[model samples]
Target: MGEPAPLAVAYDEGAVSPAEIAVGVAGLAPVAFVLPHSPHVRKLRPVLSRLGRVVQLTGRPERDAVLLRRLAPAGVLTFSESLLRVTAGLARTLGLPHHTPEVAEVLTDKYRQRERLAAAGVDTVRCRPVPDVAAWEAALSAVGLPAVVKPVHGQGSRGTFAVHDRADADRVRSRLFDGPEDTWVVEELLRGRPSGPFGDYVSVETATGPDGTEVLAVTGKHPLTPPFRETGQFWPAALPHEDREAVSDLAVRAVTALGVTTGVCHTEVKLTPGGPRIIEVNGRLGGHLNELSRRACGVDLVRVAALLALGAPPPPAPAPPGRVYFQFNGLAPVRPGRLRALTGGDEIRRLEGITGHRPYVRPGDDLPGGVGSVFMDLLTGDAPDHPAMVELLDRALPLLRYEFTDGATTWVESPRRAC
Candidate 1:
């Protein structure tokens, strides 16, 4: 009889597309996708089916565990934050290797993450979880003004605020909390140079296997927009020898402390005046960095993640000093409006150093918070140098136009003007 088909499983939260991860996993073995019923997944079913089996996720631990066992997967993979716990639970149930559910909890919840890091002697900001308005006031007072208040389980900078005083605190509190059901954290803000090559923070992308953990690349982030939204990121962040060592060392400690034994870890660190401090650790490849690594340095993180899941060694990633630089610009609208239309696609796509162009908003789509579709992820590009890359991005902004409408009126937006 022919050997049984190699089997692997993936949790699709329909958050970011898992195409890269799924494709890589399929290269080694057939993959099965699990999702909690979404039209998005259903529409992509045909394309995903070509990669592997697609299954409905029932949201019941025991029932899902039975389905996973029936599939007899050799490993499970997930990149969605909400699905981390379920993925780990399934792995545990199947007697397969995975990060424990407890560790997944620590990675997903900010408060728990800080507590665990502190216990491991890692320097993290002073933080407290406040569940009510009264507690929010107290936590802000205790942590001091200019503190950051963010959802304990938040992502993408949503509901994260920098409260500088009582007025700011009260304003954010009224808008942020609905009831005691809300869990938030207030912490002292770390100060860093406003302008720098690495901006104020950096993320270390590491891959771990049987031998040990490898710090594959350090990515430099652009300065965040107000309220802490990441606007852009560049790969192979140039760091001084000492800074690089310190950041990489802290990344290792943070991941080891959390008991992440396999797969990829994305660790963010603030370059504070006191040195690097752990911000948070993610149990998946850094968003965009995965593709950036492949485009810029020839390191395919998705492939590495898949190989690790299947208990195989990934190919060695070539060290930097390569020919191309990789980057992406997340175009977040500064005001909310209905997207009427987009113009200049052909011109923008033809720009030098421009690899691709994608618009996240559709004509007539409602744009909220002045930010257009926050879910809109743009493109990945390869340029010859930093300046040329920036120029390329700048040139595209002028070529394209966003025609939008509010309830009262309509206007044409040249993103170039905003930038």
Candidate 2:
């Protein structure tokens, strides 16, 4: 814990990382977060300052095997589950407690998760693998309308679209072309009242040891409603005590069944007529929510993971009645046009109920790819002033508007050319 140990892996050193928190927690050296592929850690491709070392690998198993041996480190961690599968041997050779390749596959695949959970008699939404139009339709017919359709191995907020009817299904899927496994799953849609307080996702955060997983925290997902898209999350779920326990129980059972040894996860569930129903699981830290958990809960997930991985005791979970929320951009168009102004920024910031925000879009610049990137985001904080927050959000949203650069006259000047 004095100074960082010599760690190895690949990641951008310039960026803020959980590695910082990991070092802070374990009293160990910063991990050498390695990137073996272009898209893996390309953006965060800079590593320096005795914090860790980067081992770039050529796109070949032999080269990867050779490279890992040269840059041996005490530990390895990754967001990509595929890495575990791709380099299990290298990790073992390096004496790292990395996730086994099979463990990664089981956690990511929706089809396998459902089967395992159901076999164990765990409460979960009925799920089946879906590969194409024929399988999609057959699964839908079996699962029924209002079913959820999503990529079998996809992450949060990615390739997930709900089909209310045939049309809604067609609208999203019309452009999809087969690539990769390009298959999906159909799950029995568990209905929750749109306005119920139990609407948020309660991600069961935990760690594992020889006996089993220890429940560290229950992070509540903030954004409600679904085509199953998320806008934010917060900790200390608003769910009643009874409801919270039920979710936690299921989370522990699911993680144990899936063989997740450590790391945070964005385990999904729906509070339904029967009770909490697990939608799926992932073997990584919760994205936006994990950061909030660090600040609010005072429990560094990376440190807990490292402890569990190193077979050490996890530090005590921080209990700060701290609430965190993802700063969500109000519903706006996907295309770029002139925005009038930001009326809500100041007002929203000033709102008494607000916590923190990271607005991804600004008034003038274009939106990035409509929307992208989020795996398990369950960290939107408290909104006690629901009525007031809504009123404030409404006022703040439209306070900004959009128009052409040339002004009112220019919009008309378009093809008319008469300025």
Candidate 3:
């Protein structure tokens, strides 16, 4: 075979950073990276050392394009939505494929995505903008109570709220949108626990082509709470025969449902005993979970995604039974106050099943963002099994700590004990 294409990966300097991916081989193709100046450089740089580095936002004209030019990568890969949006036009001009900026904007906005899906007759929540009293009132009537009032365009599930009553709806909307004619989406909350009902969940970890989309792996999600914000995923889910088939089928349909081509996707769905209902579709890799799948199942989604961006064929997918256990150290709530200190960190290094561990906040740091459990994938691995993996991850929970105080309040939404 001729030389394979070199690839460029967008290195995120922020949370859930892709810094933890292990570069097992130079087998697929040589790789290069476009990196943001990151606070976690000491921890992150080692992960990308094998790849070429291109500094971004360096005050150079068309700096990203200039960097991409230097790397001369055969294909481009990016994790930051900001990076994607900022460089999309140039990438397109150079005929580098990616989720289009238009698609990115659409995917970012639940309301916009609903419009596209609705036209396709896809069954997602009915969505609308709710900026003020009148609009919120009208949207509630349209979407009904128990609506999901979140930013129309948002990430990390930040500022997401399931509004079950007028009081909460009014309050959250007022706080989030907070202006006349400001936009937000009120949607009929599609409630489905990812794994419990189906005994497994489906996420389409794949790339799209003009002719049809390819499903790289139809991995299953382990049981998690509603909205599944923090629960870690276990690869090769302990699912029954038919449920696995159903997840695959639904993912294919959802991709068709989105009219995508040559892009990465993370579609969340619940397979109720009744049937499958898609929670939402994301136009990106499924975060650290994707990295975990790579370690456990031996698939390189980032590599495949990069190749697909160049219209190149991806390497054959990895077979299962590779490793039965993959888990995130589940999400945990940080106690408020400037991080006075963190304890039990050695626990992460010592754990048997723990393949990866990352700390987004450290001692002497301030907790500045809104609260949610999963800021990044803190740990990953192939334990003997799901329950065993969970047991090991549970041990790392106490070693970490975050303290922050500004006389302002911050709330963390981990499972009860994680607090």
Candidate 4:
């Protein structure tokens, strides 16, 4: 009998769970998961163990490369931005299919990505890396007011903020610049559509391989809070056909410019009056996008990513008519406090079009307000239509509540925005 097809997934603790991809791949072929040993990953091991063998990853890329070489896996894939370079290095070491390590580096660093996009004639906002206060002032000046300041190598919007004026810039600098002279990028904020309900931004999900790139789906993003925290996301975003095409075109250009010969990517673009501008090109699928796309369209992006990793062609991205809208709402607290009590999970589950519900924090956990942090749980809803989806969330949100203790004050508070 022929030996089992060799495949391995380099795992990282990311915003979206890796279970879907791992589970989907396990069904197709025997797989191995390589990840760093940590308490958080330890808890996930048992659940992932059901899907495939789990291997402890040494922090060093060379060591991990040696291990992967021994496994002799035919393909390797990783979803974490932090691990992209390392994965590319290992893939190169194994003489497997992969974009060069330099390309991987370009994808993770926003400044490098913007540079490449500009060189390729793709529309991009003015951005520069600020390694110190001198460069920070210059970049902010060049970018102008209403600029975004973020770490050069950051994800999940951890050290990201919008600076409206000098005071805002000072605050952000003071907060983020204290870490041994870290690098940050300052860029002009891309203008969103004036009349759109939510700020006009969409992510193009694509699967690129030896054959070429395929546009899987375009997902829309909701308005963000201060510091650009995602409030919610829904699929089948109301966009004009031309605008969608424009975004897709730019995504293809950006991917090609960066020399991404193979793999899955999530490219974000914001529609401006002039045209569509590239927000950022992500090396892997966008967070919560895989689930949203699956419900909105009959396409499983996790499976697609896995197939691409194996140097196989995935099924064409289904263009199912938008019959239902799938939305993921961020359930985040408004202030810092200790979570005393929470409720409404049962009621929320009973609501119509409820596809999935999860609470990430437990009672007594400290709530730190940020992009992904402010929330203890995520609520996903599926509705027959967009308006109905909004209505369903309105009704379901009131039932869920959070009780927190700040200093001597204990109060029950609702999340920032309902689904």
Candidate 5:
């Protein structure tokens, strides 16, 4: 038999790791990596080279396409939100299956995506763009109070905030817009249920193609820490059968409206009192979901993504999870500082239900504060039920201790006790 064509990955920092990609496409196709020039990429070259042929992007799409074509790749895909459009362009240039350039643009640009969803009647959240400080007031007035303001192009809730009143809006403007010229959007906040065992938001993980969109799983989220930083996520969100069906229906419609005819999509939806509302549709796989899905239900979404990229038929929906698998992120402090110590790591790892543990920041690493701050630690495991999962996190999280210093002062802090 002839050798399989390679799958080109538009690689970047914060995307899936080289090891994960290698495992995902094993025995299915050879792998090629396309990376933009950056110091991070420089460090990644050796690691990536061990996995596949690596090509550095020349900053021009057409030129990069020519270089990628040399690999004779059968398809192209990306796990990074920032690389979706470029990857789409490459797929088009190579006549490979992927999101069209237009679909990719909508997926990356939050304001444009909101507009497209509203116009298509999939959603009608009032949205306004804030190009600069001059436009903040007007945009706020249009969107009304209790609105959400976030960068037009951002992920990880880096600059996302809830503006409940004029004061909150002013703070968001000062904190996010004072630095440089950037675009942002303000939209009406979808009102979630007042109280529930779960967070008000859930994400539908799906794979779409010519056959149709398949709902692989619905992920449950932990409550946001201030502004809007994700604390963690669990797979097979505990939802009533009807609510689950409704969420799945809305997610399928959202992807269809956004012109997603191929590839996997992570659609974030708010479970509000009124109904399910889309937070946004991401063109790539949601961060860390692949591992969570696999651990929970034996579904390897990363492999599914690779297969879809190669124009293979979509796999059947994953069977219902036997246990509730969770990944809880230990959030950093809300004040910027250099980490000095993180205690109890050994204890947390040895906990009964603990399956895996990884520290994201170590002593001497500078950690950002606010909603933009990343997780300091990630703990993964499964539980017998939803309540049991919550109980596991409650017990395990308090074990970790953190100390930080900001030149003049040092302080010890406990991880945020939520979810």
Candidate 6:
């Protein structure tokens, strides 16, 4: 006779928007958003208020937990990696179904996750931490050359780079250490196949609950530009039956080793010459892949995550995708500049297999590059097969052009041209 108890979502800027989450859970259960006190989140208050109760966090876990307890939520969950620990702590305090605090800690800290995986015999990869400038050399020595140096806790490849030799290591050290108080780690790079139709890595999207872990889909990635900047992703990676099973099995092992027995897991695995190695395990939804999942298969992962948080049974495995649904992000120039103009959007939209196009940055907006900034452009579309999808992107990407100015000089670049 009464409305179902609301699911308290630990909200932040993440893969899914507040509006999208609200839409996903419509008619299933009400939602109560627990947001941090920040300008960006404040702007979302009005929108969140319309859909459900909004609980603003005061930056204190104990106090915030007490405040959230008043809602008497049926479950607690978060879609942001940064909020995992706090959300896990709150869920524990509230006696709800979610990742334990230890699991959250491992999920957010790359170095720690590697250690757990190595200890559990899931996959062993040498990694060393650089807490400050003093530790960089020792870490480099341990990991050796041709390694990846990345933030101990980061996403979107914001502060990630590859070191082929001493010169590259020195540059990464100066760029990362000479400025801010940050922590980083170095790990031996997993060598992928020299060439392939698909990128050397794939992400396994999975859901785990009372019935146990189920692999939802294997997402194929576009090759990275330089130091790990993503260009695009498509659903149902065109892998042979055995290769798909290999990556999927490794993903499940990584998730189980990380102590995730419930909720969704986005496990990124690098397909190396030797075997599939764990890139990292994120205890949240992978960004942008949700749209592809919904389009390629009939599964809305956002809805699945929400229902799983409410202790519902995991839905049946999604049927194999009928076509290759892809989303490509045109990366911004790898230089700090101001956008003056962007052209050719209309032409890109008309390309075969292209369905939607949206520009994330407007003219005059500051473009801070170096990180894998997908803020320049986004295009979503589908194709009959993987090769066709690749060809479609190759044709569509070069149409759009970007004009930007860095103080005195102005330059025009296209997706095919390096910035």
Report the C-alpha lDDT of model 1 over 1-419, residue by residue, as the tens digit.
95454555555542336577565555577767776666666777777777667777788888988888888877777776767788889888887767788888888888989888888897767898997777876787678878888888856676778888888877878876663338899888877645443368888888877777888878877666666777667766656789888999999899989888877888988888878988788888766666677677666677787778766653554677454465555454667778788887788777766777777677878877632116433655766666565666676667777777877988885653112
lDDT values, one for every candidate: 0.72, 0.56, 0.60, 0.76, 0.85, 0.86
- Among residues 3 or more apart in sequence or in different chains, the pairs in candidate 1 whose N, CA or C atoms overlap within 3 Å are 333-372, 334-370, 335-370, 336-370
lDDT, ranked from best to worst: 6, 5, 4, 1, 3, 2
**Which regions of candidate 3 are displaced past 4 Å?**
1-73, 131-134, 178-182, 193-202, 219-228, 314-316, 330-336, 347-352, 373-377, 390-419
lDDT of 4 by residue, 1-419 (tens): 97686677877776357567765576667778877777767888887677777788888877887788778887888877777887888889888776679999999999998999988887667998898777878888888989988878877667678888888888887776666437889988876767334656778888899888888777766666655666667777667788878888888888988898888888888778888889888887777776776666756677777778778864566774455566555555556778888898898898778867788788889887554434567788776666676667667777878888887898886654421
Clashes of each: 4, 21, 10, 1, 0, 0
Residue lDDT tens for model 6, 250-330: 999899999997799999999888989999999999987667877788678888998898888777778887888888887
Q: Candidate 1: where is the Cα deviation over 4 Å?
A: 2-7, 13-18, 179-181, 313-317, 370-377, 414-419
Give lDDT tens digits, candidate 3, residues 173-254: 5576443326677887765544422234566576676546766666555454334344556677666667667766777676
Pairs clashing within candidate 6? none
Over 4 Å off in model 2, which ranges?
Answer: 1-5, 9-26, 47-51, 80-90, 169-173, 178-181, 193-200, 320-347, 350-355, 361-419
Candidate 6 minimal-lDDT segment of 10 residues: 410-419
lDDT of 6 at 261: 74
Task: Give per-model TM-scores.
Answer: 0.91, 0.78, 0.78, 0.93, 0.97, 0.96
Clashes of 1: 4
> Candidate 1's error at 46, in angstroms?
3.8
The residue-by-residue lDDT of candidate 2 on 322-379, one tens digit each, is 3333333333333323443434345445656555444444446533322223211111
lDDT of 5 by residue, 338-391 (tens): 999989888988988899889988799998776764888888998899989878
